[model samples]
Structure formats: C-alpha cells, structure tokens
Target: MNKEKWAIVTLSQDGVALAQRVAQQLDDKMCHIYTKEKYAKQNMQVFDTDITSFFRSIMDQYDIICGIMATGIVVRAIAPNLGHKSSDPGILVIDTKGDYVISLLSGHLGGANDAARLLAKRMDAQAVITTGTDVKGSMAVDVLAEKLNCVIADFTAAKDVTALILNNEAVALVNQENCELDGVVLPNNLELLETSRDLEEGKYAGVILTSMSRQKPEFAIPSVQLVPQKLVLGIGCRRDTPGEKIIAAVAATLAELQLNEKCIKAFATIALKQNEPGIEEACKQFKAKKVIIPDAMVQMVQSRFDGSDFVFKTTGLYAVSEPCGYIASSFGKCLLEKRKMNGITLSVWLPEK
Candidate 1:
C-alpha cells in the first residue's frame, strides 16, 4: 500500500515546534503544518477565518492528522468530519508540551493507534490507546480487513459483528478461500468455521471472507462480507469515455466471472493515461489504487501478450490493458486476457502474494 499523507495542526507556537519535530522524524513530503493566522510561522499554514474549513480541505488528502492542542478543542474541530472507520483519516492529539500522544479517532483502520505508538517512541511520551480490541489484546475485524487488503461490503453489518468480538461473544470467520491467517489470533469467543452452514442457519454472527460472490440465505447472524484485493484490472478506455460506463463495464466483467467487485486492488493502465478521467473516477469510487505503468515497462511485457491489430492502431500499443496489468502486478498470473467491451479494453491479474 502507498504511504498516506500526514498533516500537523498546531494551535500555539510551542505546538508548531512540535509539529516540525514530527515532520523531521516522519515523511516531510506527505506532512503539512497548519496553524491559525495569528500563530502561523514563516513556513506554516495560516487558517483563514474558518479552522474547520482548513482542516476539512486536507482531511481526504491525508491519511493521518496530528493535532497539537487541547483534546477537547481537537475533538470539536474534527467531530463534524467523522466518517466510516475505513474512509476517515487517523486523528491524534497531544498537548503543546507534547507530553502525551492520544489515539483519538480511527485508531485502527486509519492507523491513529499505530501512528501514536510511533510518535510516542520518537518523543519518548506516553501513547494512550483506548480501543477495546487493543486494550484487551484481541483481534479487531476492521484492522484485519485492512492488513489483508480487503474491503468491508456492509459497514453497518461490520459494526454489529465487531461489537460481538469486542464483547467476547461468539463470532466466526466463514473463510471460503482458506487463506492462511499468518498467526492472527482470534478472541476467546471467536472461531473459524470451514463453511457457511452456521451462517445460513443463523447460529453464529460471523464474517464471510471471500473474493467470489456467494448467494446465501438472509439469516439472523449479524455477518459482514470481507473481500480481499486479489485481482487488479488493467484497463484502457477511449478518450471521453464516461466514468459510469467504465465502472459499469468493469462491474459487468467481474459479475460475469463471479468475482466480487471489492476484490479489485487497483485500476492499472499505461502511463499515457495517467490523467484519464474515466479511469481516475472509477478508481476513486472503488477505493482502488490507480497504478500507472510506463511505456518502456509496458513494452518489455507486451511481447508476452498476444498482439491486437485494432488495439495497436487505436491505442498505439499492441496490448495496452493486459501488459499494463501484467507489469503492474509484478508479472503475476493473468486471469482474463484482454477483452473488449464498448470503448474499453480490460484484463484482470491476480496480484503477487
């Protein structure tokens, strides 16, 4: 996964120094420093009138936001911007003296807890993590989904299932792929079931972790569908193609193959299409990375793929989608070789493990 951008919001001059210290320790490129116009330093951002507006403008751009101010003030400022655990940025708060690092919001999915731990070590401060899963030393399903590069199909259902795990209630993983857990420990009340029997009978509140779409009876179990990023679509669309059509075509292709849309890792394409609107739109909507494969790299792998005369004539490449997908996947196995629909051509690849 690409490293997410970071931002530091400091209310006082002392806080500004602390922010600069943090920027020096972590990635300077991804980090931003924000302050009120009155307290702004020479190289810092000065909020104009609305601090909330300034914060919101960078909310989606950054992965983690560290605020050096009073906890109550930071909370009120970010409360309105609170969103799903997966989509929201990690929120951290510390005093102007930088005495304590508090993991305030999106502790797991947005990495606030992890960021706190790191920054605490850097500053030799106490890291305050209060999540039930973390405090009790148990698995958090949302963290697991993120670590495994999966998507939660139903966020509301996930809330119910995670609540059970946190409460030490019976929960299970209806794992269809049987992928290795990599030593991931389950809570005392949770277990892994081989099939969906208990799920169908409403005997257990669990999670269904699979890339293939399954048709199951609506049962009493408060289960969530967790699908992994197992496939990447190498796509090339004609200029002016509507984003809806591009996204719909990808969806139709996945549906035809019985694959879950959530399993898509990214939209891989030639570097030439880096600014392609339809491709960019689809990727953003799906929460998939937009990977660009340079022409030289594409040329090296294009020979492995069969040439399409019409595609070469139109896109100036023998096989744009398949080669891009193959190269972007680090030469992973190709599942669906270049297939065309409307003005889009696409190929799917299983990402290298």
Candidate 2:
C-alpha cells in the first residue's frame, strides 16, 4: 500500500471540481478530497471548521497538501503551521482552471518540486517552481540527497553549498562510495573529486561529502555530509531481553563504529526472535524493516562462520547474526562481525555492490 497521505483541499464549488480532478491523478487510497460542506460530494470529506482550522488539523496528518484555490489562500492557511523545511509537509497550490501547479513550500527536502512537476504533467498544467536552484537549472543539494536516499548531516551546510553552486562558484564532490548521480546532469560549476583526500582546502567554495562514516576528515571549506541509508543490521538477543537494552546496544554499536543510525535499512534475526519484543521495538524505533530468517536457512549458512553450541541448543542454529544478516541482505558482505553485548549479539551488512 502507498503510505503517503495526500490531502486535496478545496474551498469553493469550482475548486472542488479542480480538487477532484487532482485526486483522480493521484492514488485513490492515498489521496483524499476535502471541501466545504456546500461543495462536498459523495465520498468527499467535508470540513465543518474554518479553512485555517481545517488546514491546520490536516497539516501533520498529510504528507502532501494540495490546495485547489488561490495561491494566497494556501500561503495564509499554511503559514502559521510552517516550522522547518524538513519537518513540514509539502504544500502545492493549483489554480481552479488548472493553469498552473505551484510548488509553494518545502520545495526540495519535502519533495514539493518533484510532486508539482509530476502533477502538472498529469493535469496538463504548467509547473511553477520558484526555488533558486530549480529556476537556475542547477542541481539542488537536498534533491540529490533525496534521490540517493541519504540523510543530510547539516541543512545549513547544504544551503550554503547550494547557494555557492547558484553563484557559479566551484564546489567539490567527495563521493567516497562512488555514489552514482543516476541520470542527473551535473551543473557545470560543480566538480567531482576522485576521493576525499583530493578535497583541498580553498580549492572549492563548498563541498558535498558522501560517506557512511560520521567521523569526517577536517576540511576548511563548508561541506555537507550525505550518509546513504544502505546498511542492514542483524541482531540476536536472548529470550525476554527488554527492548530498551536492544536499542541501547544497537546505539552503542553504531556510535563505536562511527556509523549513522539512518544507514540501517533492516534488522534481521532468526525466526525464533521474530516474536521477541526487543527485536520488534528495535525495528520500530529505527524505522527499519524486520527480516526473519528461518532456522533451516540459518543452518545452511552456519558452516561459513564460527558457531556457538549454546546458541544451537537455544535456537537450533549455531549462528544467528551473521547468517541472518547474510540472508537478509541477499548474501552481501558482512561489514561488522558479530559483537556481543548484554544478552544481544549484532552484526552489520554492507549494501550490494
């Protein structure tokens, strides 16, 4: 199921028509049509409260809010609720005639720009993107990070780097992971450094540093660290181990390894630990998928690694972390071998090459 919630808000009868059209172009399960009582139709939600109140109520509930009304109306309704760019929902405003789809708020990190462009194409309307980078036809730092599924370490640094790029200043890209730009065309002013060691101070106005480790090398110029979320964490905990302990253990392991928590994509464990509260809570807290490897699969991979008789007696498998991580990650290399902590053993897997 598409988990992203999209709210199509309309104020007038004509606006409702536009909203319905917008909803038709979006996933029906994810998109909702909301209008005033007089303008509401069957299967459409009616707002009994004032427009401002209604907008505020759904601000946190929806990932994208498309107001089928005047641009000024959306600005006024969402202004009070706006806090941070990364935290706020993407706000889009479309005219009643479907002439233009405006990317009003959270253009980059919130994905308003991309959403507006896609929606505009579907509705046969022009997309109005006002972001400096987009308007200038330059690559946006946040947009690149979003495409790579990376977490930006410093928003201020990202903004500074983006501004430098917009000003025609040279910026160095230290892509340690060889992170592909995919089909994105690079701005002429942005230069790619072969490695982090090639990032010389004062050579570029700003730098985009992409790496998995948090311990960054000291650089004189402003730099934005992009940590790709590509690692899978495999865990094996004793029966009845508390969730808090599992969480703490995982945190300590990441801290010791100088890895970002956002890099974890899944928490894999033996099938016996699938119902464990500690494993479930750890996955929930980290917002990672829970992968359960059956005992038979674990046995198949056990011969490749050292095993413990105690674990075999408990779970009918000699190894848990390594085998579970290996299977969960489609037989990827183990970056961190099993490390034991209070009643918990954990391992980290590298992303596929």
Q: Which parts of model 2 have CA positions greater than 4 angstroms off?
A: 1-4, 27-29, 50-53, 238-243, 270-281, 284-287, 292-296, 303-319
TM-score of 2: 0.87
What TM-score, over all chains together, does every model reach? 0.88, 0.87
Count of backbone clashes for each model? 0, 0
User: What would the per-residue lDDT of candidate 1 be over residues 151-184, giving only the tens digit for each residue?
Assistant: 7777787777888888877787877655557867
Q: After superposing candidate 1, which stretches have Cα over 4 Å from the reference?
A: 1-3, 27-29, 197-208, 214-220, 296-306, 330-334
Give every collision pair in model 1.
Answer: none
In angstroms, give how far residue 222 of model 2 lies from its true place. Answer: 1.2
Number of the predicted model whose lDDT against the real structure is largest: 2
- For model 2, where is the 10-residue window of minimal lDDT? 20-29
Worst 10 residues of 1 by lDDT: 208-217
Per-residue alpha-carbon lDDT of candidate 2 for residues 127-158, written as tens digits (9 for 90 to 100): 99999999999987888887777778778888
How many clashes show up in model 2?
Answer: 0
RMSD of candidate 2 to true structure, Å: 2.9
